[model samples]
Target: MTAQAVAATTRPRPARAWRAVLRLHQPALFLWGVFVTLVSAVLLWAYGPGGNAAGAAWRRKCTVDLCDWEDYSVDRYHFAFRFSEAAIDFMPILVAAWAGAMLIGRELENGTAELAWTQSVGPVRWLATKLTVPAALLTAGTTLLVGLHRLVFDTQQVPKGWNWSDNGTFEANGPVAIAFPLLALALGALSGLIARRALPGLIGGILANATATTLIGLAGPHLVPWKISVGDLKQGYEAPSGAIYGGEGAVTSTGAHIPDPCSGGEKACLAAHDIVGFYSEYHPSSQFWPLQLTETALILTVTALAVAAAFTLLRRRTA
Candidate 1:
C-alpha cells in the first residue's frame, strides 16, 4: 500500500474500533452518565445548601444546657448523607453486573463476539479493546465521584449517630473507593468469560465482588500492624479521633483479662477481674493511608489475577 493509504487505514482502525465499542455500549454509557450526574448533584447540594441549612439549624437549637429535638430538617440531611453513602457502597455490584452482563457475556452468548473475531480484529484484540475501554471509563468516573464524596463528607459537620469508622464510610473515603470498582470489573469479565451467559455471569460476578469486599473488610484491621495504648481506668483514657479499636481489656499485675460490663459498680468489676488498668489495641488516623494503600494493592493484585484468568480462558475457548 502507498504511504498515504497505509497511514489513513491505520489511523481509522483505532477510531473505528473505539466508535464501534461506544456504539455497542451506548445504553450502558448513557446510564453511567446519568449516575455520575445525579451523584455529583447530590454531593454538591449536600455540601452547599443542605449542609449549610442543617448546620445553621443545629447551631440555633443546640446549646450546653439543652437542645431541641423537634426539627425535621436534621433528619432530612441525615438521610441524605446516608443515601449518598449507600450509593457509594453499591457501586461495585453495579460495575460487576454491567461488565459481566452487558459488556462481554451477552456478546458471547449471542455469537456477536465470534462474528467480531471474523473481522479484521482478532479475539485477543477484541477482548483487549473491550476490557481497556470500559476499565478506563469506570476508573475515571469512580475517581470523580470519590473526589466529590470526600469533599461533601469532609466539609460537613458529621451528624449525630454517624461514625467515621463505619464500614461504608471507610471504604468510600479512601483509595479503596476506586480500587474496588476496578476489581469488580476484572472479576465480572472473568465470570462472563467462564459462564458465557449474561444472567449467570452477572450473578456470579456480583457474588464474587461481595465475597471479596466482605473478606477485605474483615481483614482490614490486621492488614497493617496496629498501635497499642495502655492507661489506668481510674485515670480515664480516650481514643483519638478515627481510631479503629481492635479490642479493650483489663490489664492487671498478674495478666491481661477480658473487660467486664458489670452493672454492679466499677470497683466490683475491677476486683472480680483483678484489673488494675485498661489497654487498647488500635489503628489510628495516621494509619489511614497505609491501610488504604495496602488494601488497594491487595485488590489490584486480585484484579490482575482475574484479568489474566480471563485472557487465558478466552485463548482456550478460541483455540
Candidate 2:
C-alpha cells in the first residue's frame, strides 16, 4: 500500500466518466444548442422591456398621442406568448436530445464503451457519470432559460405559453419539453446503442422522440393526468383578426392587429362591427405552472426509463 498507489486508487473517476459522456457530443446537437441560445437571447433583447430603439420611439409617440401611455404601449402581457415563442421556449429539449443521443449513441456506434468502462469505475458507473454531466448541464441551462423567459415574458394581461401547449411547428421535440426530452434522450441513447452510427442514431432519436412528442402533444389533451386544456381561456383565443371570409377559419398575423381589415372593405363592411383587439387568445397564466410541471414529470419519467435501458445495454455490452 504505497502512498502513490493508494492516492491513485482513492481518486474518484467521476471526472473521467463525465469526459466519456461529453466525448459523444455531436456537431449537430452542439450547434443546435448554441444556435437556439443565441437566437433566444436576440429575441429576448428585441422584445424585452423597451427592447429596441424603434419600440421605444413607438412607445413615446403612442404615449404622446394616447391619454394613457400604458394603454398604447405593448407591454409584456400584450406580447407574452409571441416573445416567449421567439425567445426561450423550445430549444432546451433539442439540446438535451442531442446530448442524450451523443451520450451513449456515439460510444455504442464506435464501440468505445469498453475503453470507457475499463477505468476504475465499472461500466455502470461509467455510464451513470456520463449521463449525469449532460443531464445536469441541460437542467441548469433549461432552468436559467425558463427563468429568464418568465421574467421577460410572464405577465398578468398576457400569459406564458409553450411550444408544447401550441400545435404549431414550435412544438418541442423530446428534450425540448422536460418530460418529453427525458423520453427523447432515452430513445436516442437506445437508438444509438442499436443503430450504432452517428447519423442513424441521431435520426432514430429524432424520429422516435418526435413521434412521442406528437402523440403526447396531440393526444395528451384527451388523456387524464396529462390533460392540458384552457376552457374559458379560449374566450379571447379567437384569431387575431376575428374571422376570415372565403378561406376557412384560418387567421393570419395581420388579423390579430387591432385595426380595420384592409381586405377591400368587403369583409370589413360585412362585419363592420368586427374590430381586432390587442388581445391574447391563449391565456397561459392559469395553466403555466400546471403545464410546466406536467411536462417536467413526463421528461423525468422518460429519463428514468431511458437511463434504466441505457444501463442495461451497457451491462450487456460489458458482460
Candidate 3:
C-alpha cells in the first residue's frame, strides 16, 4: 500500500457531534417518543371509536334541546379529547423545561460542554447542533400531534369540541403548535446559556417562555385584520358565524366607531349619542389558517431572536 493510502486509512474519523448530542439526551428522546405515541393513540381513538360513540350517544340519549348526563360514553370521550388536547398544549412548556435543564444547562453546569469545546467542536457548532437536532424532532412531532388534534376536532364537531376561538383548541389546530415549541426550545436554550445551571435554567426557561407565550396569546386575535361588520342601529349588531369577537360599538355618521352609548339597550341613550349604526370587528372562521400561519410566523421570529441571542452570548463568553 502507498504511504498516502496508508495515512488515509489510519486517519481518525471526526466525531459526530449530533450523534453525541442524541446519545447524551437519549432519555429525553425516549420520553418524547412515548408521549407522541400515547397522544397519537388517544387522538386516533377520538377520531374513530370515541367520536362515533359520542355522536351516536348524543343522538340517541339526548339529541333534543338538553343533553342527558347519564351516559358515561359522552363524558369518557369528552374527557379523553380534553385531556389529550391539554397534554399536547402543555408539551411545549415541558419541552422548554427539559431543554433548559438537560440539553444545555446540565452540560454547562457539569463542565461537560466546556470539555466538548476543548475537543474538535467549536462552541458555536456545539450550540447549533444542540438546537437544530431537537428542533427538527420537536417540530415534526408537534406538527403531527396538531394534525391529529384537528382531525379529531373536525370529526367531533361542536359542543363535544370547541369553537376556533377556543384557547387550547386554536393553538393546537395549526403550525402554532409546531412553531411555539421551537420557540420554547429556543427560550430554554437562552435560559440555559444565561443561567449555566440546571435548576435555575429550568425555572428561567419556564418563566421566560410563559411571558413570551402570554404576550403572543394576547396579541393573537389582532395579528390579522379584523373584519368590521356594520349594520343599521335599528338592527342589532351581529358577527359572522364562528367569528372571534374583537369589539362592538356604535358607528356614527362620520364613520367613527365608538363604544356603546347605552350598554343596557336604553333607547334614549342610543339616540343621545347619534348612533346611526353598530359596528363589530371580528375574525371569521375562514381566516383560521391565515391567523394561525401569521401567529406561527410571529413565534418563529421570536425564536430566531432567542437563538441568535444564545449564540451571541456563547460567542462572547468563549471569546
Ranking by lDDT: 3, 1, 2
The collision pairs in model 3 are: none
As a TM-score, model 1 comes out at 0.85
- The number of the candidate with the highest TM-score is 3
The models' CA-based lDDT, in order, is 0.81, 0.50, 0.88
Candidate 3 lDDT over 215-319, as tens digits, reads 998898889999999988667797887778898898877889888878627778777888788988999888898899899899999999999999999999999
Please list the residue runs of candidate 1 whose C-alpha ends up more than 4 Å from where it truly belongs after superposition: 1-15, 64-70, 158-161, 232-242, 248-278
Worst 10 residues of 2 by lDDT: 241-250
Deviation from native of the Cα of residue 237 in model 3, angstroms: 3.1
Residue 145, model 3: lDDT of: 92
Where model 3 places Cα greater than 4 Å from the true spot, the runs are 1-11, 157-161
Tens digits of lDDT, candidate 1, 56-120 = 87787866455568876666677777777788789889999888888889999999999999987
Least accurate 10 contiguous residues by lDDT in model 1: 256-265
